[model samples]
Target chain A: MERWIISFCIIAIEVWGAVYFFDIFMERKRKGWLDKGRYMILYLATVLVALLDMYQDTMVIKVLVAVLELMAFCAVFYKAELKQCIFFSMLNYSLLFLTDIFSLLIENILNSKDELYALENPFWLVPMKMVRVFLLIVLRWIWKGKNSYGALSYKEWRKFGMVPVFTFVSMLVMYFCYSGEKKVQAAYLFLSAGLIAMNFLVMVLMQDILEKGELLRESALTDQKKESQLSHYRDMQALYERQGRKMHDYKNQIRTIQVLLKEGDTQAAAGLAERLTESIFVEMSAVNTNHAVVNAVLNQKFHVARGQGISMIFRVGDMSGMRLDGEETVILLSNLLDNAIHECVKVAGLGRKAVINIKLVEEGGKLIFSVKNPVAKKVQVADSIVLDSGGGMHGVGLMNVKAVVDKYGGDFAISCDQEKFQAVVML
Target chain B: MKIAICDDREDDRGALKALLEAYGQDFEIREYGSGESLCKDMDYIRECGIVFLDINMDGMDGLEVARQIKSECPKVHIVLVTAYVNYALDGYKVKASRFLLKDDLEQTLQECMDDILREILQEERVMEFGFVEGNVRLKVDDIIYIETNKHKNVFYTQEQTFNIYKKMDELEEDLKEMGFVRIHQSFLINMKYIERISSYVMVLTTGKEISVPKSRYSEVKRQYTLFKGVE
Candidate 1:
């Protein structure tokens, strides 16, 4: 009974750690009602699965139980779509399967009497649990979350799926070989270990490749943003200069009128005044965001939004203490505001009144940026995977913004209903 | 002195020619209404000590024309004449000897002509650096900025960009006397190329924007204004 309890505890801890690692990696969102009692159910469910695996001793039944547990966890807690859930399920099971197989191989390789006795001892479970925990921690550290796995396209998903499928097949084959009646000799055992290490090495290398591809794409987007922002700044400067020139010309015209009045040429002075009023046009007031780069982005985006006939309301309060550098500031604001304006324009095209509300506030040492725009078109935002089929990767800008925010270790959230799409970033 | 006046507008060309003629300087003047004709007249450009290039010419605007002229004859002075006052900042990018506003031609024209003559008579400073192909020389006035990439420094002049394997500190020290300012870890810009300093951004004449840190903005601005004052 004591051994049974020890086995249950070991299996429970392993399940819990795996779930934690999956949550960190995939950033799954939990249903509101299931949030409080999900962990208790997870522990109970893991305990029951462990009992079934131990007593039944059927590989098929054990696999079925593990699949059911993962499905239940994903259905109850995770808000991913069917495809994403399946992908993550395959990932989670493959990892757990590899770890279990690795432990068994280690046991088979060290087949001395003392080693066998140590494996049976309940105290030995602690080191086993520790090894699993350490491995999961390192895996999480290596898996950076800037380029979200959940947001990959179908082609990318297929490429990523190959690694897990390979791991599963290799680890399952090794497990069957070791578990067979044929005595596992040292030569075969060492070869199996070598194969498993190679499997892991392939996984790591694939992840590195994915990471580098994402980084290259991100930097390319950033370069594009920089180019646009430079043009935007120049446009804003040109507009301001035009306004200044008008003012300067007005002053000169006023001086000419004064000289004409002094010589009592009232007719010429009146005509000049008429011409001045005729050339006068409205120019929008400048936006001052305390930061020049942010100001330029806002001013330029506002001009664009206005040109699209979308009403824009901005309430900026004290952004001096924000930590973003000039390039990041330009990229973040322009991308966010540009996305918001695009969405607003879509609503306007549908004959609906479009409005964009932007607010920046500093609270508790965090700079909170929120942009809300109405959307007439449909948008599906599951966790962070925002998708719009009509827009064709329109969410790229927001993802880029999220990447910048993540670089600062900041918080970002996206929520949208049928009427409105809202994004909040805190840094 | 030999002078060339290039403007797409015949009236602008005539007006500038009349202004130069009224200046009472011993200058032989030629006029071209389009940049193509002016560029085609390489012999004229070689003989001409100064060119009054209109910024808004139809084909080959002033900036591109100035780039071509400066690359061909580094010693020749190019003065940008424009109705737009904002082109003053853009003038520095191509190392324009001076800028003359069409609106205030009576006052600005004489002043611009005097500055152009002074700059033409002054000795030019050129900096040489080695690249993959060979050693290249750049007139310090023609260079807008030098930026550091991952493994090399890119020297940006009006006409061309040269990649050189050199440290930023060494280049900074070398260009210090030539009025280059280190505004960021990765950026060293020629003070002469600065068109405007608005907020914390230094807008270069080449239309490139460089960010200035808040803590150092005032000092950079002060140094830039002092440099302008000295000029």
Candidate 2:
């Protein structure tokens, strides 16, 4: 009865260490006593299987049942996807296997013979189990709050899962082939260390892949937004052309009225003049500049700003000397105005009338563009570029603007205070 | 100040003259019926501070007349007036300071005159300081930046640097309205000369780079952007 009780205590410690190890990377699904109760059930089942294996001497059945119980425990108590649960379960079980192998290797080095005899002796078994559990807890503490793998998708989890799965199978095979020979024991310790190193390498690689993927996705979204903005500007240009034709017709009608008044029909001439004036529709494309692209982009941004209840004031000088192509003009102006509008909307939300001031001028053979808007939060700028604090797509948009400015061998500067932010580009 | 209006139509010239008179500034106004007649008097063109030109003149069109005037007097502020919007692009080729549509001259004329007057004031404004060598007069627009070093303020321009015994705080107050910005404790820079800012460093058009402190970087950048927009 004493021996059975000792086995139960050792098994409880091992299961508890494994549960905490998996908890390092996985988030809990629910909180409170219900979650604790689920963990208790998992602990009890794992200990029961381990105790049964000790008496029955079936190592394969014991590891299989323990792995399934851990996986089921993760699915029930954690908020991870299926692949993530499976991957972490395999990783946890492999670490437990490694700790046991490490303790056995140490025992062999200390005794040099009678390894099976040591396994049956309570004095040896109790110390070995304590060492195994201590190693597990130490590892869990070192990786206490790290969740580097949390950002990855299920596909990535599946791909990276292979490493732990391979190590676990190899460990199982090594356990089955173990003979009390000194050569095999030495090989087992070296192989276990190699497997642990491999798992660490996989973690580093996963983090690198996550960062690169985020940047790639951001740039793709920026390009897509640019394309849509360009198309919308093109559509606005077509509308302006139609308006131009309508204005020409209105002019002809006015001339006809002038001729009618010259004749004896005064009432008809008055009626026609009044009707013509009433039919003339005034639209938002009132901005007229020397550059067609500038006019289009400004009008579109003006419409957007007005829709959001933000006022935009433009002081545009002659832009004929700007020397930029249509696409470059759209990219530069649209990005600047879009960012300004975004800041203005935030300011408007705070019960203040939001206003954006934009200026585009050609001075001394260079095109200067600037935008100023009120800011609700303090902005951070480094090396003259505004740093994105929220990790959003705003940073990517500014990067595109900077890229265009660099192409022209120009200058870009951003400045902000507690209540306002401004961006300026000279090309 | 001398203001000149050149147009082929008599009524159009009268319309511009009436608007100029309503501007409430004391000016000696001269009228030319054609572009050739305006270009004939070189002495009058040289002394004029601002010249208004009509683009669709009868002979030696406004653009050619503008090019000739710019070649002779590069400091003259040329205001180009046109009936159609297409001529504005051609006006830019001659380096016109402002563009006005004849259809809405009443609304745009006041703003144009305000800008031209402010620019002329900036061009004529000069400051005198007691330098270590002697007292020197310098154009406010020509100053690129000022660095405070060893209890002396050094003013850097395109041609030379002048050292004067003045505090930076006093100089910043005097030059703030004239497009100067205090980017650092030791540096007071002219916004017009700023080429770019990168990595906490402000690069001037004269190929000089000044490092900005991390604490003051954001405010400096914000002030620079606002200065560019206002200018």
> Number of the top candidate by lDDT?
2
lDDT of each: 0.69, 0.76
Clash total of candidate 1: 0
Residue pairs with colliding backbones in model 2 are A383-B199, A383-B200, A415-B221, A415-B222, A416-B222
For model 2, the stretches where C-alpha displacement exceeds 4 angstroms are A1-328, A334-367, A370-423, B133-136, B157-161, B194-231
- Candidate 1, residues A1-427, lDDT tens digits: the string is 8887787677777777857765764544544455667677788888878766778876656776786687778766765555556656666776666655556546645554313224645566657667667767776676664435433567766776686666656655565555433255354455545654554564466577667767777787777777756866786687788689888988999999999999999999999987676455223334555666666666677667768877654445556677888767876777778788888888889887676766665544667677778888658764343766632244466766777877986656666778877777767
For every candidate, the chain B TM-score is: 0.54, 0.93
TM-score of 1: 0.45
Best by DockQ: 2
Q: lDDT per residue, candidate 2, A27-104, as tens digits?
A: 776545667687578768876776566677677677777788888888888876677778788888877777677777
Fnat of candidates, each listed = 0.00, 0.12
TM-scores for every candidate against the unseen true structure: 0.45, 0.49
Q: Interface RMSD for every prediction, one decimal? A: 19.4, 10.3
